[model samples]
Target: MLRRSAVILVATLAAVAGAVSPASAGGPRHVRGTETIPVYDYGTAIRETVWVESPLDSDGDGARDRIAADIVRPREARTRVPVVMEASPYYACCGRGNESELKEYAADGTVSLMPLYYDNYFVPRGYAFVGVDLSGTARSTGCEDVGGPAEVASAKAVIDWLNGRGTAFDASGARVTASWTTGKVGMIGKSWDGSVANGVAATGVRGLETIVPIGAISSWYDYQRYNGILRTREYVRYLHSYVNGRPAEACADELAAMRAASGETTGDFTAHWAERDYRTAARNVRASVFIAHGVNDKNVSTGQFGLWWDALAKHGVERKLWLFQAGHEDPFDVRRAEWVRTLHRWFDHELHGLRNGIDREPRATLETAPGVWTDERDWPARGVRDRSLPLGDGTLGAGAKGRGVTKTFTDESLREDALVANPTAVVPGRVAFLSAPLTAPLRISGEPSVTLRIQVDKPTAALSARLVDYGTGTRVDHFRSEGVVNLATESCWGAATATDDACYLDTTEVTATADHAVLTRGWADAAHYRSLRFTTPLEPGRWYDVTVPLNTYDVTVPAGHVLGLVIGQSDPQFTVTNDQNATVTLDAGRSTLTLPATGAAVTAPTTPQSITTTTLPGAAERRATDNTPVVPLR
Candidate 1:
């Protein structure tokens, strides 16, 4: 860790020193060390206090209640400075706290706007920072609905208030003069605060410039409920932390609400919990955004990045995505310099009208492995050729042209299926596929979908599929959604169940549950399997496959990479009904996994003709090569 830290520090310093242009240095002085700058020294700074009533009458009680904030203005202020608005529930109990804990603003001649929960971090940066306590949290009035619309409205109201105050800083020695209203504000925060940034962006409020939403949830339903499987472990742990760390009554109420909502868990994207989901809100954000997520983030899945990227792309809004190699609770300073540099360039270009060339940088910048950063033109870059391999006898091979090979399993040898549910225990009669070694650097940039054809003697059964990367010895367990289908039930398309024998069923739409219902009485529980397919982009490499316990299936790979397909019957992690006497078959050629393809070059297009290219935060010096995964463009 020490060696790694040193390398990161060195790389950051080199990047900053090399990236900043001589022309972009005039806006604000970059602080390299701590100095007693008057704008940030609370002792010397002029301080003014004020309160605003909640614009939202929460209880429908027409009367508004008060929210608090502390405004600091530098004694000598000139122009309308850029505003930094911080939204958080974490507040200082008393004024006398650690200097680091305070929201420090620009101490060296920048406007410092400090909101209530904001510490002194805003002041030292010369930014007119406003720290707001959304709705009812902290010293503010109204109930804290967390990231609900009401809280979002409250944030907007605060922005509006700041706008009305103009460039003038309060009595405190901070910059609050009307000369600082650039109307372009940047919102920054993490976790719940990050969610607030997302919510405010969704409101489509004007003058809201750029946003940096880090470690935030994009979909509440998919993340919190575990596809409606009632993730008791995660829920319990979270509630415990909330209850212990937060005020007792508030935590208790939240816990109670979660408990009551347990049975309502359904992984369906359209469910009630998804209403407040950030993915839904990301659709409306018009501002330039920089989204960062920890690859190993457990509380919130890395899948959120993909979801948001897709949404933003669909809306034709460009964004920058960075996936760090950190965990949920890790400190932001791990990548602090890069983050600050990125923000500086971004805000300078947008807020200060500086041509910092941030726009010329790749649309997607990812820290693929530990310390290496790679640039790509777009997310899931095209030209990621697809290659499919076949699954058979624990090995992966190129599938016969237009034909699928098959294997069979009987009752006595169904141990392979059981192993997936219990990794320690291997079940017999399980089929596995191992791919060939990768010949080149390849990334399965998108989700893989599968289709299967089989016959089960039993009237009902369930199927599950997963994609694994054997090279890194790490399972790409991340998925947008994992689905299971019940064979006993009639096929349904757009809400219609097919009761006929000849049915072309697409299992993607079918949602399953633990509850059982009788489908048919059977002498032999038999349902013919037509085909099995799993679709995903594969780079140039070989992969491995494992079967979900208890179900019978097949594996087929596309053209560029090797594929491993595992067929099984039951997955303990998922609820599956295992009945007696199941027979499965793979229809040759007819079964296929269709992977989405983008045929264009994977690299970014040549710098746009009209846009002049400028150097970025680290363009000059060539850094040492390290073993880091190439960052993909998004």
Candidate 2:
């Protein structure tokens, strides 16, 4: 087994060498000039030659793209070494001069395989690390369709090369060898590389071990479109940033073809996208996996995590999820340490027959706010109890205190609580709900659901609910979900002359025509206030029933933490245009909000079990530890 000191040495070396250059009195040396930016010089190290180019013509194409990677022996000269392979479009040597910056800022500096350094971390750790620039990208020759068949085949071919080299097996190719016995290869990458990891895992190639795919989407369609809504901004920007200005016009052409085939300047989730969706691909993955996502990531909705989680759970695939507070950038140190430990533990047990205590970690490690991490036995912890409070008049409270009370008013009374315009006022015209002082701290670790029974005179209506946290007069908006229901669907009739209901309603559904749609609701936080919001069109003589589910959350309220729920017609942050002139009524008896609960004390729910080697079927060893850190191999 590899020693802990060795592992820490490798990590520290990689961090220091890759993270920054030795600071000299003269400041730092400047390197390459790209985009008018000066790149800095980082220290470098020499790595032993693991493999030489040994070519093969497997397809009889007479091409030398199929070269077996020379297997590098582990630092400790172990018999079997775990492997991690990464294939990318980024030229391996492109960032050779900025190894320090690449290591420090790019994907949390763990991806220290850039050609410039020549000291790939995986090779030194006794793990065979393979880097191939997929055919047609960089030095490789062939059409680069991204995740198309060529990419998948190339991945399989790499596996074939590994197997053929006799590195993963004996000379006879019949059994494991002392040089490389475990015969497991994991995939690690981000963006294009991350997407290919999933694609390759879906190929069902043998010896393929675990996968860590960060910030990559499986299907191009689901990411660009949701339901029927068209997401034009983010997708277009991504294509422009990565695909444009490249010397390889073929890559750009492929992207153009996809856009042309979709036939919309702004792409919507067409039938084609749904067919190649990642959620569907997730169903075919057999290897254990971990996914990391950023909650405030505007590029991709955090809901994508839920989609993958739900699919894997349904398929009974062993998987884990980690949510971060950072953006699309690599996670912080605490997170990076956890990731390194996880990868080491997983690969150690599977590839080296080490009994490191990895399998004992929780299935999910969620980031509650910035620095807080919580462990759950499974996704969506079981038996989430729901509690509902009422909204009435200007006050928010429990039970009948605010119920059955209608403060009837003339135009003057309505003016006090309402803002008038062709559409409703976009900001500051909403009411907030506050919960009574808490006896102890309460935490919510799942999604929130809300049901509102309302009365309005208009034929069509839209309502939004927002959850907020109040501290020192600063109201921080947390989670939000909206429901837009046509008045006709609720059996209420609008004026016949009222601008053709067909234009506002489609197939009996109310849809948001603007960017601030109800579908765009969800956020991740360490804690939340016991708060609720109610906003809708006000009309004379009609009542409506509505329900909206706020985005999922993992909240921990400290003891004596005051809970406040605010109900408002509109939030300034989300400006809704074209508000219909109407009056709104709230019925307390028929309205309720549900909060998550576990039948037991809120503080003490069932603890989750960690993944361990013992739980695995054919394990050669085992270790027990009380601490959650990965057990060092020695």
lDDT of 1: 0.42
lDDT of each structure?
A: 0.42, 0.42
* 10 residues in a row with least lDDT, candidate 2: 493-502
lDDT of 2 by residue, 1-634 (tens): 1112333443445453244333234321211111000121121211221221223322224553332232333333323445677666554323211111121112422223333212233344445555555544444444444455555565656665455543332223243333443457777665556667777777666777777766565665544542222343334334433422234553555556555645243233444354445677666777777776554333444455566667777887777677654433333222544565565556555554455555666777766654567787776665556755555443343532555754321111111112221111222433334444345656665556556665655533334455442221211111211111123321111111111110111111111111111112421110011111112223456555556555445455544333433333322222221223334566655666566644222211122212111112111211121111210000
In model 1, the runs with Cα more than 4 Å from the true position are 1-52, 59-75, 90-125, 165-180, 233-271, 281-283, 329-331, 385-432, 449-466, 472-634
Candidate closest to the true structure, highest TM-score: 1
TM-score of each: 0.59, 0.55
